[model samples]
Target chain A: MADAKPETKPKKTHQERMARKKQVIDERIAKATEERGVLILLKGNGKGKSSSAFGTMARCVGHGQKAAVIQFIKGRTETGEFKLFKDHPQIDWHVMGHGFTWETQDKTQDIAAAEKAWAQAEQLLQDDSLDMLVFDEMAYMFKYRYLELEPVLKALQNRPKNQHVIITGRVMPEGLLEIADTISDIRDERHAFRLGVKAQAGIEF
Target chain B: MADAKPETKPKKTHQERMARKKQVIDERIAKATEERGVLILLKGNGKGKSSSAFGTMARCVGHGQKAAVIQFIKGRTETGEFKLFKDHPQIDWHVMGHGFTWETQDKTQDIAAAEKAWAQAEQLLQDDSLDMLVFDEMAYMFKYRYLELEPVLKALQNRPKNQHVIITGRVMPEGLLEIADTISDIRDERHAFRLGVKAQAGIEF
Candidate 1:
């Protein structure tokens, strides 16, 4: 026991620890072999929520799966994503063209725009043929009470079992986390904007 | 004062508070209007770090900016992303094709593979023509001591001023965060595998 060099850690311990960790992870991976649609929620104050949702959309498209996106807000911004997927056959993309709620300013108009977008989303949700749907900033609709949560939740519940739905926003609704199979809370610990770093066209838009 | 109801907050107070918040945000946004390529670090235990990086790459490509990806660890698996970008003219991608370290079980081979990949990455890093570069899972190389960190860090420090770099992985090195303009700590609040959900071909890869 006296000869043991406990103070100076050895490499073998690291390997052993990693091996054990890998074993547990491998088991979990093995157990996670079920194939089905998953509800993914990206919430909190972070830069990458919409980026993540769009990334997954690309992933879905990469697999040749049918995918659609309904932007609940900022629908008029000419994002690079719109240009990339605009002509792609595998993607069904829609933007409200009304811009942001604050910019629109009219409550009645905002409600109508949200309703129009929701109708498109409801169709996608109910379609058994579609593989994936992205509800971009849908959480804000529910948060602002522009649209009721029950109908959207009900649509999600009634969606085809194999259709994946991804919702991105800050401060998700009350019961969304419980229903989501994968949830990431992206905490913006450091933001360049706060430090006078501007949002680039390709990066931030 | 006598007519004021203490139980009901004044609407003007609410408007004034919101106006103050908006002013702060607007100031930050205005101050952030300066344009420069950022060094972004996505760290923590979450599912979408690499996906977010790739999404950025796609966004860059969407804007017609030249970009590249050097996947350090997960190079073998034919990701849906690879298929999507293989023929993309604006994007240059390289994968080790060496798979994971545990699977190879050869330190020399792993080091060699990492070095080969790093060489390509260095070329990209030094290329001013490339608007963006992604070192996918590059943090692992530093953590595992596969490649010397000093040289890589030097390359990053000396890279083109207008070039953007994004590094994705868990538990980044000490000095990395200081160099990063934006950092998102993606917390894995919930994972589907915990509930016996599996990684699908298009979804997980």
Candidate 2:
């Protein structure tokens, strides 16, 4: 005992702690047994919310699964994602907004566009053939009162069993939050645009 | 003026507030004049860090730009991303780890693997031909002391001016944070895995 090195004790303790952590993680992994569709919400004033959704859509397409992208409040058709995925065989891409709310300035037109978009979304929600759907910037509809939250919530709840839904925007309503299987709130820690860097084509859009 | 209803006053006030917001946003947009590649850091204990990276990769490919991805600490070859992006013409994908640290448990081996990965990254950093590079799960190396921060920072600083770098993981080092032009902190508000929902193949992998 007297010959034992001081570092050995700490090393052993560290191993024990790691072992405990492993056990907990293993247990949690084992506990997760149910299999079904999930509603994932990506919100906050961050850079990657839409990017994350697109990435997952790519993954779904990679798996040979059918997917659809409904872009609200982003009317531009020249975005890199739109250009790439618009004609993809397994993807249905739609740009449904006139533009940003401030740019539109016409509440009636914005509401009409949102309603038309939601009408398509409502139909898509019932589509079991589609493995995934990306409701890009859908939260703004709720935040701006463009669409009723109840019907959207009900449609989400009643969607096909194995179809995953990904919603991305800057704000999330409480009703959507309650039913979300996963919620990722991306915080904006820093942005290049704030530092006098122009929003480049492939990076920002 | 005396005939104006209470709601009309609020409506005009709202428009004035929106006008001010639009001016601020326009001024900020105009102020950003510099154009260059960005170093984006995606960190925090949340999902979609790698997803966001891969999404941007797709965007880059959409624009006909070359990109590379170096995955650290994820050893699985059957991931959805690997299966989809590995064969892409514009993408150079490399997976360089035995497994998670807990699963490996060999400090010497992990360190060696990290070094090998960094060597490739260092070379890629100098390649102006590559438009973008993703060092996935790289922050763990710094947190675990498998790699030093100084050399990485220096390489990033000296990289091709038009080559963007994206680093993703749970914890970001101070050095990396300092150099990052854009940083997104994805917060885990809720997770399906914690609620007895199994990690699905396309969604979780």
Best-fitting candidate, measured by TM-score? 2
Instruction: Report the C-alpha lDDT of model 2 over B77-152, residue by residue, as the tens digit.
Output: 7787888889989899999987876677667888999999999999999999999999999999999999999999
DockQ of each: 0.53, 0.60
Off by over 4 Å in 1: A1-23, B1-24
Interface RMSD for candidates 1 onward, in order: 2.6, 2.1
Worst 10 residues of 1 chain A by lDDT: A97-106
lDDT of 1 by residue, A44-154 (tens): 897788888888888778888888988888765468778787788988889863755545556677789899999999889989888999898988988878889888888
Candidate 1 Cα deviation (angstroms), residue A4 = 6.0
Q: What stretches of model 2 exceed 4 Å from their correct place?
A: A1-10, A13-21, B1-20
lDDT of each: 0.82, 0.91
Error of 1 at A172 (Å): 0.5
TM-score of each: 0.91, 0.93
